[model samples]
Target chain A: MTDLNPSRMAMVPFVSVHDMMRIVNGDGVAETIAAIADRIEADFLRWEQFDKTPRVAAHSEEGVIELMPTSDGERYGFKYVNGHPANMGRGFQTVTAFGVLARVDNGYPILLSEMTVLTALRTAAASVVAARHLAPKDAKVMAMIGNGAQCEFQALAFHHVLGIEEVRLYDIDPAATSKAARNLAETDLRVVSCKTAEDAITGAQIITTCTADKKQATILTDNMVGTGVHLNAIGGDCPGKTELHRDILLRSDIFVEFPPQTRVEGEIQQLDADHPVTELWRVIAGKAEGRTSTSQITLFDSVGFATEDFSALCHVHEAALRTGFYLDLDMLADPDDPRDLFGMVARADT
Target chain B: MTDLNPSRMAMVPFVSVHDMMRIVNGDGVAETIAAIADRIEADFLRWEQFDKTPRVAAHSEEGVIELMPTSDGERYGFKYVNGHPANMGRGFQTVTAFGVLARVDNGYPILLSEMTVLTALRTAAASVVAARHLAPKDAKVMAMIGNGAQCEFQALAFHHVLGIEEVRLYDIDPAATSKAARNLAETDLRVVSCKTAEDAITGAQIITTCTADKKQATILTDNMVGTGVHLNAIGGDCPGKTELHRDILLRSDIFVEFPPQTRVEGEIQQLDADHPVTELWRVIAGKAEGRTSTSQITLFDSVGFATEDFSALCHVHEAALRTGFYLDLDMLADPDDPRDLFGMVARADT
Candidate 1:
């Protein structure tokens, strides 16, 4: 294999969902989350070099399909994600995604993996990465609002990445809350099921809202939040989907992924366009402050950025190669006779 | 298999590049070309219902990576393609691509295949579809400038779809011209290698320029273009990457797959944004006239639209299913407990 024939070089490796599941499972969730968080922070610090675009979305009656792409001269990563709110009714997930990472020099895919589980992992990793800088250092308790598929990842990430000792969970769906609780039953972190969103946030130093309704919903109002409560707002990503109340955004010191995208999709979308929100990368690069004072309210408005996917892709490319759990997809043409693609077809028949 | 459990009701077949090449070779190129051409034209006629967007591109110093996505309410398709002009120096093809087609209802990918070859096939099919409508009814000859990897597909498509009997080929690389000439030798259509671009277009009713330079190279200047010649501009797809002279665009009655995209990535990008160009769908829908007079020069400014991919995806989906040439990709999680993605991981490790 090291001889490096052009014909063998044409094959692209495809990482299946099963393969990705194995990689993540084999590596252990805590280690994978920590590794990806490190990657995200590293990628974010050098952010200006990337070619970024607000995702292109195709909206339908049921849901939306989006394509998010970014590149950094050397490699390009894109995630194809669909948000079908009604999919859960058919025993499918509300969000299902897959991503590709390619070498920009040759334009050949280096990684193709199921991002349904990986997205959950990266989103949680990103949230914790931001929270570590913005949340109080001694913050031991975290409140998680809207316990769904993403809830376990959030719970595990905060516990593993931020050293959160306790998690208070609440959701409209009791079954979803139970699922999160059952998933975390074997873990060391204490999981307390709360009756309501307010009950969950009562004594928690950090509040994480991850509700998935497409419509604007006030999961966290000003009355429910207090000083020094670091808010990690997820799930309020698309245009009309929001989680925090208007007053909560107005009162808190906010940090965001990309200002251009966060302004439209984050909790800050409820605020004015000129609102002085800190970019997360600036804090990672030591150019801006995070959690200025013990008593100051801080909010991490995370709508999931392409850079996080870029970082996760880099991590997965290395892991998949190390594990050799992927299949070699015949995804490119033979370079022996570049113009003889027709011959590939002709010879197959003969 | 037919008396399966309800969960396995409908199998969405997929075709890997290896299997697709086998199918194409087994069926014969002429037969495959005709079938693909038929699918393309039929799909083009119903283009109104499609969800179309200009491709999202991440451009680097050397090239660009783009995601072209579109849907027809029932099925969604997207192609990840890259154009690295410097890649040929690195012993890589200038363009490499792969794509997916998914059920809109379930957001489950039905077909995933290598588009490096399919792209060549579809791009040519699109040109032929446009030429069939935009070219003169009695057009029988084509002038193919920039005879490179795409020239064979163009020749075969034009021959099979537009009834083109002869092709005059010209390229900066004479070897490329000879390669194209040699590939088309097996076909009934006569291939003539010309010494210059002007000689190629001498008496042809249709002129197709499929050059590969990443810059604005004028393969067809206004002087070489005579009256009533339909220009199929196939290569000038990215911003600042153009093949035709601006004056040639100023003179011809242009038709495009998607006008907004053609304005930025096609030859029309050289013209003003306010330039009046008709959408090819309107002509296919019989709402507008095509090639009004034999003396009227009509041009199909092709940048390769996403809708064409949606059409091709459906064609591939059906073809692969009927022939049973697909690998089942474990891309989505159907947990025994749908909520227990972590359980899948835990079980895998055990």
Candidate 2:
């Protein structure tokens, strides 16, 4: 007979941000990102195995906080993320998050880690993953129009993964552009601060737009978009929030994470429901075309799906376990007698 | 003028099960529960101020995992929990959970805490909060069906908050009953183990049926119910999972946490969409009728809502902060150069 005390089942494993940074640094951020990209791509190929749904968002006057949950047959995961566009005024990042990975067999969380930094890494990795297939061949020059927290990651991802050599940066906030340039100072890739979005996209083979605003900001007009440039629209992810002009979407062959979610929260929200777009998984799985021709414009409408987080979470779980960087959390009740959970608390008194 | 080195946010505080137990033991569990009950009531009264939505649930063949998120003006909170009926066979508890509490002003997580222990506390506190207003005056005995993880908490909260002196417990598993009895050895309230649900409710004034099964189980029959019995039906929480017979609901006045959510996920899922059930908030606010007559049988068919969690998280946040039983988590990117989030990743020479 098993003992009925729950004190024995009391520890959970947790990885801190410092530990995560150490792992990212030790593994080489680019290599770590590449690994995560592979995991995301592989997961995307088997998209039907997941229980996918549109994220549940609670919109307030300041911003929105959302819960995105998904599960395969054996594992379950969810991410808690908040988007407060006005947060910079209060010294807070525009987006912040954390997530959990759990075993579906027993409903026990196997891993819990900070996802703020991981989201940045995975978002960049996901963009690169899509661009590698969709961007034109020899796409060495890129335009990044956000120059915020996500700008540097976008630049590095392209430089390390897609072999982009030059990046033109533009932001409404000049300090943001200066900061992005300063961060990329050590990298071999050339980074230029541009005065306008049009100047940033001049001669760029891939243009990535990621401005942070809760309004309908037409950052890029159709006339400014050049042919053969892969447009990664990363911001403008909520209802009533959009980045690309509707004309740009009409001209580009668009690809998205999940079609159902993208229709509401992606740049495609500006387009009609009947608008034809390919699911990124179909392109990754070789069923659909990504970059049909060198002259064709491709757009990756990334609203940050749950499957990417699912992949990133699994990768982090393995890394945290192998590196021994996580603290034990008593989040599960392991009553010696599994049926006697009440006794676990009672034993705590002893 | 703030440094944005990318990882410079206020630390996130955490309260583990041990930390929560210390707070409860130090402050007196009953007092802590009473305090939380007050918080829940206050939040419910200002319902229009909150951003409320239905929980996001991922269901599998074995059980279900859910993310329940809600926010008032200042703070946002969410819980990650799973319910697996077969977990006992694998030596795991039937349920486990953890959650986050974040600031709405900046979208940064202010606290992360284990909700397995806290869930038990909050669920029971919510039951008591409803029973105090809906149950008959001078109610002193509770007939508790299903002696599982949530059984003891229900017993203690009623004893501590509502002055219930005796509890009649029944479970299909005898070992579970023994565990409940053992856990309550330290409490002054009397515990009675009964052979059947019918035997348990012989003369009890409040009948709380909290069985654990992921299927439709008629734990309560209409013939077994009595007048003036405030039935706290807690176990029937999913689409096809219900505890009481449909006839029982027809005979009693039904109340719920959130109607739209309860109509789909609570015991009332067995009823029609236009069923004449009252939101528990209405009764607490004195906007609707509760127990108007001694012969009235009121049912609080609760499928635990996010508002209750919002209250529990806020209470725990303040308590944990005062007790200093929490650890700080670097869950946000506080870039000294906020735009240079990539630089926060210390690059490798390789």
Candidate 3:
């Protein structure tokens, strides 16, 4: 038998947080979000081709860690994400994530990347995709409720992808609203800082709620929401974490990413298990109605599905290849003789 | 507000294949296996403390990819593995794996390691752990029915951990037998290459069947097995794969890792759903009977479980820390203010 060097086969491209930041900045955050939104829209059009499963989660006293996996016949991808609401108080991010993409044919991982930044981009992009299909055609104003880590991305995605010209921001913490207002000062969008959620949603066509609390707090009540509005709820992702009141869901034509998952993790978790909700993919595929009438209240109960992460990973893998912004990580063991794994380890001694 | 740098919180230690090999060689494979086996045993002793679930798998036409996750109160771990029987024909491994270990409190990954080598070590160690409880006290010879990738590790583990003096090997392919024989040439134990399965198990007290076919080929029959022999079946891990005859399973007392998993993926998949089997942890925990008499036929229907991978990851994490054989991967996005994720990405531009 000839000695085969497994180093080449073992090398997997790794995009760290630093590299991910570079990739986002290199293309510009709004441009990157638009590109990922395109990918997400394309993937949603062919959603039936992908394998989708609700994320497997382990809930602890302090937080929950989840593994979300999906495949599109040709490629497979998964993301490891943790949501520790208390982590922020302990000088840690409330959410952190990483993902991998592999070939379905050979089951070899080709790319590993930090999804913390990518997920934020993808989440905002996904919201834009939903709003494009569900929102009123001439919608230009967006009310950003519970302004936090995701506020700037949401504002930009809507501004660049959905053409929203104004954003009204509000959070329980006055400092959070100020931070978001300061960040969006550079963008062309008209930014408004409000003292209350009710004030933020006034006269807005699009309302985005993305609070970071782990409890079931009603960031938007039934009386607060107005007619002919699109609600992009991003913060009520986990089991106990919900943003909108049950009355809001009852009044809206709810669109979800995946029903089985959204029924358990989204704002609709407050609704019945068998509530009639249209899958957003159906709207993208032109099989179902997104927003039937101008006065119809539309709510996108976004829990962030696995396919979105897969699309984000696909985008990152392509960007890494095009820009050369990644390191090759030797993460797999490939011996010349596949059966000679023990021999390879033994030879390492010499 | 203070500017906080999250780079330190984002860095996760990664042990590459080269680093894994260095750690294994530094501690010696057999010694490492013994230490990991000790950890596995200790974990099994407290089996009820863990949150166990069947692996989440995505099966394709060519192969299956799976995510196995388990968590104790303090820590969580998961392994990503794939089984593609045709991969070896294409100059790739039949199986490749990697794993991560994280702190449960913050849900942040602390370590990532290549598990192809660590899996080989853990499988052998797990086998030794089972053999110690199920195999006869005076068992010395082990009949290895399949001389494939896992052959040498199994041999060395039994030889070193269980004091097995001889290993008789047999394979349908002569080259596989020769490979196993050649690899074990430097060991003190006697290596006997036999022509057939029947010849290999002639006078052995323990029989190990580890063939890699994805079909139900009976490597062992009821007629071939004697009274007191312990069977270690490792290869029939997925559905439609079984190494031993159903009649042999009917005759022996079965012990399995996790019943829900073993029932679907282990050799016991050949049996009825209601077929009784003892959980292996019970035997380790002194809660159940093992090897009632010298004549009792004990069959350990081994299907790899998540806890085994967790133990293996735990072992690798410690070894890497002790030997400094790992790289810090910037996989998470940490900002001084947890809510200012967009700010972190924006600052990278300047």
Candidate 4:
């Protein structure tokens, strides 16, 4: 920054992974998820004010990297995230992310934060948000299929926010289920480690399928999903990858984040192009119906969206401010005279 | 970044504005521009290997914010930039930018750099690249129509690279011309500050126009341009902006970086949709002719491209490595167990 206008405009508050953990600890896990959910829901209600776009993705043989950008006329935010299926074998997370939030008026970034933890929190919060309006009024049990990285976050989020007392968990690899169960040992929720997807979904009002696969696989059959249950299909996100049988989608009232994107990447890709689905924002805003009857099967086809990331970044930004767990990065150059940038660089050392 | 892969994979090298100065001064400014131009040209030679896209811009009344992303199979890079002409009045730069270079294989950022200074360097380098191929062999004196932020850099680049012995400068405001003159006073090249645009182009064979404007405006006329001269039309960019006359465009043999983008944003937008123009990369690759005759008018319609930025980043990444002028940013999260992201956060406290 220059001599006259130095600190405020040039320095951006950056929250690292270490600081993210500290902030997460300062705010309890489930409570933070709920807080992000509240922000997501609030942003969803006023979705019309935003300039939205589907995440721009670059696909390679390894996996994919994506940039999700959105601006609410006032402030702009974007997340840079990658999904590499083989990363887990190399001791790397299948998905890692970071995000930035900038002012729309001057296009200056205000906050730069690690979003790996925040993405997990936001994904769970978004599920809870959809379940709030789509799930049964008296829902108490959540069956988590493919209990891996997102398992505990989802379980804790549902346990605290949706009043789910028990989580029935199952994964193809029994070791994963055991890890999730052990992690939830301290939590108040009753953790049930089941053997099969059918066993996992037994007597549960909400079922979450988030198995990781590079190719298409039906983790859940139509016979496994009962009426009056809310299904959160998360792992069938990219092309050529899906989790539920086509018949199951036929029976459920599908809700989506952004239909144009969800139609191409979500579980709904198995259905027709014009298949009627409710935009989740419309339901959140009360402009459309959620769950009409107890017999209705509701499914939130969750591929994730930019606005949810935007909401999460904003929520975490406020949390960082309150907790004082941020470092200022001198990422932008400011000169005494805007037109004399070369002169600033020339006289920098002096 | 974690314990197992903490040093190599966990920490990202971050170059700030102060360090960028160290780099520019360490390598003389003219030499740095020439090196960046070499990288840009090398990338241009292998342009087919890159995934290219025009920048995604979010426009507001105040200015516009843009994201320019590209990948060359092995590496990926993107820049975040904003153009707010009114920022100069508010004691802020009209344009500010930052960029990131990441491994395409795993999507981990290898370099994070402040591009405010680099952008100025890359812009000038790109111009000289065009002039080298399009300008006359005996071209000596260069005319600078806009003496703003980009003026002095252009003059120095041409002086060092193309052997432009003199620079004739002009701007609507005399102070801008004076500032540019003062900045270049230490150099060996003769600096002539002119009262009018016509006076500036009197004896120069190469002309550069980079005045800032938000709408369409003609800074140069067809009659003012002479035969055997090279025109570097840069000021008129964006959808509604251009700096050259339609008649001037008709007379000149135009060459552009990318035809699709130049058709919409460059000075060639004034010409017909099917007006014949040579792709600059083809010319660089020897697929097309550059200067058929010294008498022909050559115009390099320079709208900067993503590959140019990618080259600049790769170049600067190497330079920062050699100079050791970068800070390590703990921007990514690496957990021991790939699927145990929640566990990592839960245990980060200890």
* RMSD to native, candidate 1: 3.2
Cα error, residue B293 of model 2, in Å, equals 1.5
Q: Write the candidate numbers in order of decreasing lDDT.
A: 3, 4, 2, 1
**Residue B249, candidate 1: alpha-carbon lDDT:** 88
Q: Where is model 3 chain B poorest over a 10-residue stretch in terms of lDDT? A: B1-10
Q: Give residue A192's error in model 1 in angstroms.
A: 2.1
DockQ comparisons of all candidates to the true complex? 0.56, 0.54, 0.80, 0.71
Model 4's CAPRI class is: medium
- State the lDDT at B275 in candidate 3: 99
In model 2, the runs with Cα more than 4 Å from the true position are A1-10, B1-8, B347-350
TM-score for candidate 2, residues paired by index: 0.94
The residue pairs in collision within model 1 are none
CA lDDT of A243 in candidate 3?
91
Report, for every candidate in turn, its global Cα lDDT versus the true structure: 0.83, 0.84, 0.92, 0.90
lDDT of 2 at B329: 67
Model 1 lDDT tens row, A1-350: 11223366677777776788778888988889899999999998899988877888777888888888888878889888888888777767778788888988777887777787788899999999999899998999999998877888888889998899999999998888888898899999999999888889878999998888898998887888899889999989988889988998888999999889989888788887998999999999999999889888998999998889989988988999999988887677654556556655555532
Q: Evaluate candidate 4 by giving its C-alpha RMSD to the native, one decimal.
A: 1.6
What's the true lDDT of residue B173 in model 2?
Answer: 86
Among the candidates, what TM-score does chain A have in each? 0.96, 0.96, 0.98, 0.98
Stretches of candidate 4 exceeding 4 Å from the true structure: A1-6, B1-7
Can you write out model 2's per-residue Cα lDDT over A274-340, one digit (the tens) per residue?
A: 8999999999999998898888989999999998999999999999989887888765656566555
lDDT of 2 by residue, B1-350 (tens): 44323243647887877677677777876777788888888987887777778888877878888888888878888888888888777767778788888877767788888887788888899999999899988989999998988888899899988999999989998878888887887899899999998999988999999987878889998899988889999998878889999999998999998888898878888888998998888888888988889999999998998888889999999999898877776666565554556766663221
Q: What lDDT does model 3 reach?
A: 0.92
TM-scores of chain B alone in all candidate structures, in the order given: 0.95, 0.95, 0.98, 0.97
